[model samples]
Target: MFESLGFEPDWFGLLGREVLRERRAALIAEACAWSVGLSDRPHHLRLRGRLVATGSTIGDRAATGQALSGEEDGRLELGDARPGSFQDALNAVDADGAVFADRFDREVIEPFVHETCVLAADRARRTRPGQWAELLDDLGEDGAELGDVVRAGEWEQPLRTDAEHLVLAALGTAPLLEVEAEGLPLSLVRAAEATARAAAAPRPEPEPEDLSGALFLALAAVREAGLPAPVPADDAPRLLAALAEQGLEPDEVAAVLPHLDLAPGTADRVAALLAAA
Candidate 1:
């Protein structure tokens, strides 16, 4: 399936995994930053001081002028009458940390997966009519990217999972290239879905590739979705080079097409799109 769109599943899988890992790392970093900010609070400093005072007894035992060594008490002791406050502070920090982690996991990580999945699915249904379900099924069938995304719950897991989802979504349902085939691009399909969803329109089911006019509509939709209009005169090689500059390949580019399943005419249009770009 991916081959038709110009991508090798294996390479794309690796890329997907990397993207997932990176995303999780970013989320974790953001959480850590929040933790750092909390740690800077005056309340935390006061609490820490109390904890040190209560926990420590070394000062009492150590010679007045002797340097305190780790071998002596194995832990630091604080001055009298402050241990309780310090303990309270430590507890607060711990609790805050837990909450931060939880929020990142649920709020940022989970929602990202759902949004990316929905976007991918919407595009698939538009581009690969009569095949969206099958493509989605196949993505999850062999424990490919789709399954990985669905299994993601943590930072790294979700990011990797999303990568899989993106690849699967991109390649999910490209229409065959044919003289009479539609020329829809994946981007267009996604845009249309977004529009429909916004309007509360009943989501359209995938349709079989029919008139060539669909290609124009799909291309227009993609443009509306933020992609540049199709280029003219660029063949596979030039297009591949251009997309490669954007960290993509011909196959990946093909997967982005909603009407890739069409015949030579549609293929030529794609080539032209690439060339013009």
Candidate 2:
């Protein structure tokens, strides 16, 4: 799996299993129960089953509502039971519920909100159509690979491919402070090298914003592909030159190209540039 994701553990494990599954009902129910005393018995029961399957502490399982309620407060305040922390720290935060929020952080909402972001990141990384179809099948016949998910609309493709997939995966996972942390693909190394060169080139006048944006996008796409992050400063120029020497060209990078600002003639331009090179 690591090799497949370009030896990036962060990118490989970026997708969370639960977020990929149909979890709105459970999450909504958990939130409702805590905030407004709304209880979907079935939803609660399903959550309970998940808790049990995961072998979570009883107190932790019971604490979802309480922890959520304490969203305003950072501290989690358990009535009395002191269960061990959760296996997944995010999940544990949810398990801590209002109790943790009430005591430690005084109802700070960020911790709880971040849990949702993490879940989304995992869901975004999920690309298995078969498994997703099975899940939809469970929802209903209409749910299985619904027409909407099967076709490209305004977007060029029905499903994301290569670099686009990586970008969404990174965004879904959150906290993308650096390219190295994103675990992008090596396919992007060339693009990064190219962009860095473009960005650093000592032009007489400033470069166009589009050029800069394109360069950044190129670099980002490489990382999303699970390749190594480009080295910094002077080191990057050598790396870019090496990639160019290896015959890495624009066309070779189509699969990992960013969707941003892509236009009707964009594909042709990229293809032509790559082919000519």
Candidate 3:
């Protein structure tokens, strides 16, 4: 008997036959309950004419029942009355009416409904470009105007991409004129007009250099002394040559020559010529 049952006779005598049978049944029941719970849908298992395990499926597949047996050593087996894999059970659960309704609303219903409304507006704009005022009249006396809607400041980003701006511009809506100006293609006449306006604008004159008090006094003294003004055309070369011999750079000469009261055009011409050298 012991050899056939795969246990030593001495062990059976120590545990007693009834105790061993009860323990084995308990182990089988525990294993069965765990294995049944692994099913994707609710499942039941029985062992030794008694209900042992029952549970609903979780995650993707039913938990592996054979592994749940632990050290039971193949003494137990699972029986499936539902006749399907764990995946099939999950599909049935998802197909339940309440679950399907909730999922459909979240995944498919809301987005397309919003898109359809926007597309309808776009279609209305395209088909009835000149009749926007007539359409607005249907809104009754208290309804919001197109100008009010454009100035609301809340729809700027959305209107940035919307095709409706072009329609509003075509309808001669004043509020959208700036948007129309920015978005409209630049014609050759408009481009030339912009360039001419820019060119005609008055330019600010350059700021005068700040002269030292001693430099001002020296200039005043020269004027008072009635010294003859040097002829820039005759004196510029000699002055530049003397400065160059003293190792003065062209930039240094340019800086110094500006302080001297030269003829109206001579200072600029001398600076430009020497700086190039």
Candidate 4:
């Protein structure tokens, strides 16, 4: 999946493992006496009275035997079901109801999104800075002489706006090609032109589904939850409303919501809206 999306497979796998670990931890912490165990089945949750088995599917005969023998004590068992994909696991937990869904997003999805963005930024940092000579060479006429003048810093006039564009392209920075046209060496024009061409050359954009949107969602939830969050408190309601418009119920929203030291049970209130949904 990561390869298909142009991500480093090893990085994706590392992130995936981290997400699974976090998900398990959060579920265990919140389970309240439920025994969580790992299972190989896709759907591992089996709730019998208070005994919740999250691992391998118990055969009917075994379940009956356990029930008859009084071994079906009240406990929650978590299983390690190998989900087909990260998204599949997320959806499974979501469908399990508000509590599991919320925990999954908070413990797994949000962190995964954060790490994905970090990776993307790291990759972007490795992009080679454009060269000035390379820009000059792209200019057909007077390219070489202009390259020399640019190197010597003895150019006269400011490059034309179009030439300036080239400089911006090559350096991935604003052009400083402006000079007194009369005193400017002709070479600067070609330099600027080359820079613009380099800048305009196609470069890969981050994938549309690179978890940025998920990160934004997590941050917005935090902002809405209150101050000490990375975003302003005033932006919370707007962000929450936007998220609501995306078909997330208050409970689902609250599951991934971050909170400040302020208002308590904010998540409960949000989750309460699940009924209205």
Candidate 5:
């Protein structure tokens, strides 16, 4: 399965016969090499594959990957899956130095991105106002950017407005979802409201667009939970790059549709939305 996702699982080289507990620590180190791409299966695999192929003489570490995943609630799930919080894995290596730039981004940038999308989705779900307000305060204390945006107020209206147009394309939904906002956890609302205010005000040059990060996250969640994919491991740089590059052309869109697990029309719509963004 790992192989299908563009990861040549050289499990032996990565672990070198280490015991299960030790293997976990080792895996943490390997995954941290480029934590920015840690969420990207293809990138993670590519890094692991590098350690073995480079002629590192070591005993087989055994299969740490196997241990990293297991079934819970009759469904497969990944363990220690905190792409942001490294509470468990932090002790594996000393992080006093500058090797942890991306770690803060997990919280500073990532959560806002997620919260923004959740608000945009406006779906029927649990709503936590007190918790969200507290978290927003916490995020602002943790990062300057999010705070600046939130203080502006009116940060969420555009995203909710844009959701009317882009959400369908983002999630490839038809007939629209009946789910209500149920009170959104303050994510990208601050950013959206701030951008709107900026646009309304006069400036020498058009402010760089502050695109809502919510749409992508929403689409990805729907795709993973509802869409059919070629086993998560089948990911690759080409496919990931296409996703990162916002201006996806028709040809590029066509080329990647097969791998996306999205319908042809849905993929085209997604491509158009991305391109227009």
Candidate 6:
């Protein structure tokens, strides 16, 4: 039970076991329906694990969609329904990890599927006389151990493995993300769509870029936003010595050049250099 969901205690004992399961199923539906529209991953995962534990299936398609964000074209955000203010307060913005994940999925996950399929067909031709097969005939026929054909990184392997299973089930009863129609692993769809999104996103054009200058400005913002941290006593003397070696005198709030000269910008520059380092 997510306390953050804010369900009334009066309703808790009022609902029977069946009703509770239904409630969990509904939350799972809402989460899956919203998918990436709900931007809280840790909470989402927690809620999802709970929901799945309650004997409700999100289904293969919905589960796959949850593994990655779906089409943003028609997504309606869950404003107020799922509070994002807490995560917003973290004040951190870094998409490099996501970008790298996308690349790894695209470059690694997709290839494993293709190579595995081709080599499996070749192996079937060589050893087991069979009708034409795409993914290993053993995939459908028996629970055979996977050969060391596709070398997938651990980061993307679980998703790729799930996607491979989905590919095997693509033509069967339930609907899917149409990834198999193009003969691709379901997992690769996430990477492909992400690539498309990245392409469509507006990018900042490089102009008269001063990376160090930007770092300096960013350092100022960090200092303002952050709690005052103690500078290490041991390191301060070393930094002063370094500054002296370059023929400048260092102080806590100010610095001097030899023969009565004040270096007004030196502190900020030194801070920026530390940040750059």
Q: Please give the CA lDDT of all the candidate structures.
A: 0.38, 0.34, 0.37, 0.35, 0.32, 0.33
- Total backbone collisions for each predicted model: 33, 36, 5, 29, 14, 0
> What is the C-alpha lDDT profile of model 3 across 1-277, one tens digit per residue?
7689986443212222233233333322222222232233333333353433344333222233221221211121121212232212212223121222133234323332233333433444456555434444543422233333223323223332231222222321221123223333433344578799999999989886454543444455435544347526545555555556555556555666667667666566767668677
In model 1, which runs have C-alpha deviations exceeding 4 angstroms? Answer: 1-99, 136-277
Cα lDDT tens digits, model 5, 163-271, are: 2223222221111011111112232454467689999987688674433343454335445444344423233333434454455444544454554454335554555
Q: What is the TM-score of each candidate against the true structure?
A: 0.24, 0.15, 0.19, 0.18, 0.16, 0.18
| Model 3 stretches astray by more than 4 angstroms | 1-152, 158-232, 245-247, 251-259, 264-277
Best by lDDT: 1
Off by over 4 Å in 6: 1-98, 133-277
Give every collision pair in model 6. none
Per-residue accuracy of model 2 over 1-277 as CA lDDT, tens digit each = 7688676442212333233234434332222222221111111112422421234433443345222121232223222222221111122323323232222222212233234334443353266656555544544544323233222111212112222223223332222112222333432554578799999988797653344444555555445444343333333333334335444554434543344334354445555555665
Clashes of 5: 14
- Candidates sorted by lDDT, best first: 1, 3, 4, 2, 6, 5
Sliding window of 10 residues with minimal summed lDDT for model 5: 174-183
List the lowest-lDDT window of 10 residues for candidate 4: 172-181
lDDT of 1: 0.38
Compute the lDDT of residue 132 as modeled in candidate 3: 37
Global local distance difference test of model 5: 0.32
User: Whole-model lDDT for model 4 versus the true structure?
Assistant: 0.35
Give the per-residue lDDT digits (tens) of candidate 6, residues 1-277. 6477886342211222223233333322221222232232321122322321212222332333333221211112211111122111111111321221233236544564444433443444455444323333423533143332222212224435544333223322222222222323333556578899999999998784334433443334334433223323333434344444444322321322121122454445555555554
| lDDT, model 2, position 151 | 27
Predicted candidate 1 versus true structure: per-residue lDDT over 69-92, tens digit per residue = 212121122112122221112122
